[model samples]
Target: MVTLMRKQFIIAVIVAALLAIAVTFGVKYAQQGPTLGGDFTLTYRAESFHFAEKAKPLNILYIGYAKCPDVCPMALSHTAQAIKEASEKERSKVQMIFISVDAANDTADAVATYAEQFNPAFIGLTGTKDQIDAAIKLFGASYMIEENKKSYLGYSIAHTDRLYFLDKKGRVRDMISSPRSSEEILQKIKELL
Candidate 1:
């Protein structure tokens, strides 16, 4: 009877340990974000740009036009600040990609200039309307170009003002939205790193 009781106790303990391990894995799997799919062959500095060459760097993709009046500038500035705050090693492990939504007005040079104003490390990309539309659809982003007769720019683009954080595997780990401070954005990036 004593031996039987001891075996039963050991089985219970083993079962509890197995249960704990399962729970740990379950929670980790649940926390992982969805993968961002889509292939983009855009122009950067008049050359073709591809994400595949760069390996294992966290990619922060922001879609905005170069002439954006408010939100895009603010968000890019915040991203610059966050990059500045990260350690050299941490910064090296990240890349920021800014894609232009106003393809009609924002040329490759214009996009590069605008992005470099915020951070020289940023890679700015612009594509044809079809390519841009494909990227937008893949990311589930929305944008509309509205003609403004009174405005000097001739038109304005309304787009989703959010930052897409892609992990090493190209999975979207988190989205940092507008109204978030630089520190908040930095913290999110740090957590991913």
Candidate 2:
């Protein structure tokens, strides 16, 4: 009887230790922001584009579709204004990347054109479903494509409206959602710079 009680106690202790370890890792993960930025590659200008950490030094990433009528255009315009407001040195050290969540429709070239309309320095990227999904997971962003027969576009993507900021090491350092002003974005840019 004593042996049985002792074994139960030991099992409880082990379970408690496992739970503690899990909580520790969870907290660490929460502290560390998004991962897998360096390894993620998507198509840009008909070529595989990956972060040039030292070259760009900073990256502002926005995830949405080229066909997005409202949110994407405004957010990207706001981002462009913020970049324009930055000093030439600050602008040179940064690259704005638009990743199209609508992999099926937004081709690499199409995405590129969409981005350039806001700023010539801006870059746009798209990839196969799997590749886009990998990037989405890498940045901790989420999107859902829903078909709307009554809508003009036939389908619309409900995607994360946050702008993800990657530092010189290509690690996501911050994220801010839309409806944010140009001044707010510029402030974040200056802070990151």
TM-score of each: 0.80, 0.80
What are the lDDT figures for the candidates, one per model?
0.84, 0.86
Predicted candidate 2 versus true structure: per-residue lDDT over 135-181, tens digit per residue = 87877789998988877999878998989888766678777888368
Assess the local accuracy of residue 47 in candidate 2 as a C-alpha lDDT between 0 and 100: 91
Runs off by more than 4 Å, candidate 2:
1-36, 52-55
Give me the overall lDDT of model 2.
0.86
Per-prediction CA RMSD (Å): 5.5, 4.8
- lDDT, model 1: 0.84
After TM-score superposition, what is the CA distance of residue 95 in candidate 2 from its true location, in Å? 0.8
Q: Best lDDT goes to which candidate?
A: 2
